[model samples]
Target chain A: MLLMIPGPVHLHERIQLAMAKPMIGHRTKDFSEILEYCTEMLKKLFGTKHDVFIISGSGTAGMEAAIACFSKVKRITCIDNGKFGDRLGKIAERYTEVDVVRFEWGKSIELDEVEKSLAEGSEALAFVHNETSTGILNPARELAKIAKKYDALVIMDGITSVGGDYVAMDEWGVDVAIVGSQKCIGAPPGLCAVAVNDRAWEFYNEKCPFYLDLKAYKKKLEDWQTPYTPAVSLFFALQEALKIIEEEGLENRIRRHRELSAFVRKWVEEAGLELFPELNEYSQYSNTVTAIKMPEGITDKELRGELKEKYGILISGGQEHLKGKIFRIGTMGNVTIRDVVTTLACIERILVKRGIIKPVLGEIEA
Target chain B: MLLMIPGPVHLHERIQLAMAKPMIGHRTKDFSEILEYCTEMLKKLFGTKHDVFIISGSGTAGMEAAIACFSKVKRITCIDNGKFGDRLGKIAERYTEVDVVRFEWGKSIELDEVEKSLAEGSEALAFVHNETSTGILNPARELAKIAKKYDALVIMDGITSVGGDYVAMDEWGVDVAIVGSQKCIGAPPGLCAVAVNDRAWEFYNEKCPFYLDLKAYKKKLEDWQTPYTPAVSLFFALQEALKIIEEEGLENRIRRHRELSAFVRKWVEEAGLELFPELNEYSQYSNTVTAIKMPEGITDKELRGELKEKYGILISGGQEHLKGKIFRIGTMGNVTIRDVVTTLACIERILVKRGIIKPVLGEIEA
Candidate 1:
């Protein structure tokens, strides 16, 4: 079965075999070598000169680490334009006082509002670079620039954007950025890589949660080790996945993601469907996933369920309040042009069967 | 190569193959069914009626969760007799005020001292059930009983002991217990199973680290899901490992661990080697691993290095100040008599080559 969700995406056979390799002692030289290689590759994927620590939890764990370790200010400003952005705010609230700038699920955040909030004693700004839930890519570079003017540390959740899109973390002055293994890196779930700028260490919270403490990770990386026992097999898989990323070249991979997502958007328009996120000058469509409004006359169940049961394809439906109103097609991590075409074909077939739209000539074949 | 260290032990072929399985969406019904199965099997392995939440991390993360979530008190008494025990105290100190009762490594803690410490306004007691570092099993039942007398909560780290030994969490009044996938469960490292008694919920700290929060785990378990995206491939491997445990029968598995450890002890005596831990009536040697003092004519390098270079076997040496003073053999998770015999033969050959001991008749064959 093909996995077209935002994460836990389709796995390559090489990665699967890597995951099956025998376990080694986490403290051994062999494991350390693997850790070092993965760390180096992750630094490339994150576009950072700083150290990127591999955490043995999901992406949200990395988000929590980013906030709990660096949110040492009197108040932090968080942008909540979608589910993941809202999560950043929630996690930050647990660490310090938070001022959450809220927006509708598929709407872009106002830059003036973010700047105003940061002006009010907020020492940090946290936001999601690509909001997977709403399929919107927030203006990370612009936000980081705004935060820099206010002398506020910028924390970005690059989970769905880092490997698949252009995320120049160091160039954009992102103090802390996070990515998930199951997304563009295309390994598996359970590992989160966090990149921290050297300057961000000044805001480190000594009382941060022990398991997710970035300081411990940094100190241990000096010896090519994790502070705690890592999921050794997952590391093996991640190394292989990173090798695949390196082989493809970051620029080429980003081009593929952009091309596929643009293709999906074009298909939605041709098939009489609307894009979910309301795009503005600053906000753009996510390169990794496309959220489309459910076409008229076809229920979400009829559209998604038929795709899964009949075509062995899995796509994601809208989450939270947007449930049943939208559908998402993820084209991240090892996704090819053929896979996208097949998915579009299946969606078109389902819509045709439901009498939602007339079949377009040559579009299904394309 | 054989893995005879405390964890990341020898993995069965089934478990490795299971890890190679394709990824699945964490929110899907199929994944939830797998989660439900693993949770039930983990409950049985932990010998508890309470819920067991699976965290996608190493065993140390589980230890941190146990302490951070439940150490909400004026002072939590932590036991520090070995490396793992000291870690429990260190993690507890970050969340709450801690009174660590220190003891010499491999030495039994004084029960009277523990009682006195608990009597001094401590509201909880945290300790390791199996001190894998020194190959000793602390008196978990007795400690829980003592903590109960003071009406304090009991938290136990059963990382290396839960599946290989008899750990009756509910019966022993253990408020919270943790186990690792790599140890007695016979899976790869990466997943940690935590069992929480219903009564332990009252002490839950809302400020606990967001990623490792027990309350979030409990709430998500109601829907047969994890709070965050789990390590999907690791969960597949763990489920397969749990199946192997169920087939072996918990009582028989514990019996095998006990018998193998006893065999190791007898071999130590026959080889004129001393046990590492100073055992007492209240303290016993660990069933999952055996620690032996370095003999007279053999350096740790000569013994362990030869075991690894000449013979394809891996064992653990001492940590911290005890480094080079002792070596440990782990017999947890699918360890067989033949494996033990082969390891013993290798050790005997190294000792004889180094002029440390005379070869015994029929012992090498056994």
Candidate 2:
């Protein structure tokens, strides 16, 4: 079975086997060494000199942790263009006065609008680097520059972009960057990684819940440990996954993902499907996922059901307002060109069965 | 290495293998089935008819979630006797007005004292069923009865006791009980399980943090789903761990833990060591772990180092005030009589080498 969800894409066998290592005491020297080693690799993958920590949670946990610890400002600006972006805004609203700069779900973030919002004198600006809900990669670097001009700390939700795309937290001056283990890391789900720079540490809030407190995490990091017992198996998987990423080289990995995403997009167009996000000079499609409008007269449920039940291929349907209107295919993690081609073939077969399009003579094999 | 920590106990190979399962989309039917099956097994293990949900976090996350969702009352009483107990009280202090009933560490909870506190009209009584810090199993049934008499809801931290000891949440009128995956459940750390009874749901607060909201969890439960993406691999490990528990039978499993704890205590006595807790008829020692006073002239660091470096055995030292005064041995989660005996043998060997104890004749196999 193939899993092509926006996250938890697909794990390599090596990373999966790492989960089978025997349990070690979280306080033991062996685990300490492992924690240190994993932290180093994570720092490299994040392309940051800031401190990196592995949190035992999904991507949302990292987002909440960031909000819980750093949103002490009087007013924070959140750019919402997709589900994840809206989620960041909602979480931020709970802790501070939030100014939400909204955009269409499938549209790119307008730098001019964000610059205007930052001009309102906010302490922090939170945005999603890659909006998986609509397959749009926002211009995080440019937005961070505008935020820095206003002296606002930049917080990014890089869950699907960090590994698949070029996300340099330090380079972009992102104060806090959150990534998940299951997306492009090729690790199992259950671990969230966050890199926090010194600037972000200034806003630490002790009033935050202890479990999600960044200060507590920072203190524990001194001893190469976490405040709580993490999912040790997931940590092991992450370590192995990071090694794979290092061997592949981040640049090569980004290029591979770009090629795969482009290949998938080309297939979608040939199959008479349209990309959900509008393509323009400023619009950058996410390398990790591709959102496509459903063919006419075909419901998302029927298409995804047939893809799963008949072909053992699992893709994701639209979420929130876009539900049943579009579907998403993830080509992140260990996915290859063959996997994408096969998925496209399966979708074409299902579409043909539904009489949505005529098969190309050369594309259809005997 | 042998892991004899209070939690994150050694996992069985079968449970470890389950963590190696391929990634599945959280929305897939396969995942829904796994969720339903695992939830059912967890209910059986928890011995409660209440709703059980798997949270992707350490046990502390479950504690915070319970406090966030169920602490809408005017006042809640937290019975603080050990480190974990005090933690619960501290977390409760953050959510609502809290009345703390304090007791000495390594001491039992006096029901009369709790009754007096509950008389002040608390909406809920929060305490730890088993205090891992001091290896004391509080009288959960009696306390629950007293809380019920005052019409106060009962919230229990069963992190280290749920599967190792008898935890009849419904039978004892426990409204909410939190357990971790790495303790007697014999799964890796990362996932936390919470059993929430219908009565506790009445106090649900919308102001609670959305990520930790129980209402959202329940809404997703209708379709055997989590509101956010969960640690899927940990869920697989948990399913296998629960199956192992079912096969062993909870009664037999509890008895095994009791026997292992007893064996370790006997060895400590023979080695001229003393139990940390004051033993009396009212004093119920935890079946899952045992705390022993450090031998005279032997520092915890020295003793633990030798045990770990030479014998590859790992035990835990005390926390906070008890640090350097006592050490703990865990006898839960896939641990057998043989493992206990081996650990005891290693300790005896270390003591003999340090000239703290004379070697027993013929006791050494060599």
Best by TM-score: 1
lDDT of 2 by residue, B1-366 (tens): 888888898889999899888888888678898899888888877779879988899999999888878988989999888999999988887678999999889877877888888998888999999899999989888889999998888899999999888889999888999999899988889999889999997788666665777787889999989988999999998889888998999899998998888877777666677888864455588899999999887799899989999898899999999999999999888898778878888888878888887655224321
Candidate 1, DockQ to 2 decimals? 0.86
lDDT per residue for candidate 2 within A122-190, as digits (tens), equals 889999998999999888889889999999989999999988888888988899999998998888888
Q: Can you tell me which runs of candidate 1 are displaced by over 4 Å? A: A364-366, B364-366
Best by lDDT: 1
Superpose all Cα atoms of candidate 1 onto the true structure and report the RMSD in Å to 1 decimal: 1.3
Judged by DockQ cut-offs, the docking class of candidate 1 is high
For model 2, the DockQ equals 0.78
lDDT of 1 by residue, B1-366 (tens): 788898889889899999888888888899999999999998988889988999998898899888888867889999999999899988998889999999999998788899999999899999999999898999999999999999999999999999999999999999999999999999988899889998888898888888898889888989999999999999999889889988999999999999988888888887788999998889999999998998888788888899988998999999899899999999999889888888988998999887787776246323
Q: Quick one: best DockQ, which candidate?
A: 1
Each prediction's TM-score against the native? 0.98, 0.95
Q: Write the per-residue lDDT of candidate 1 for residues A1-366, one digit (tens) a residue.
A: 789888889999999999888877887889999999999988888889898999999899899999999977889999999999989988987889999999999999789999999988899999999999999999999999999999999999999998999999999999999999999988999999899998899899988888899999999999999998899999999999989998999899999999989888888877777999998899999999999998788788988899999999999999899899999999999999888988888888888887887776256333
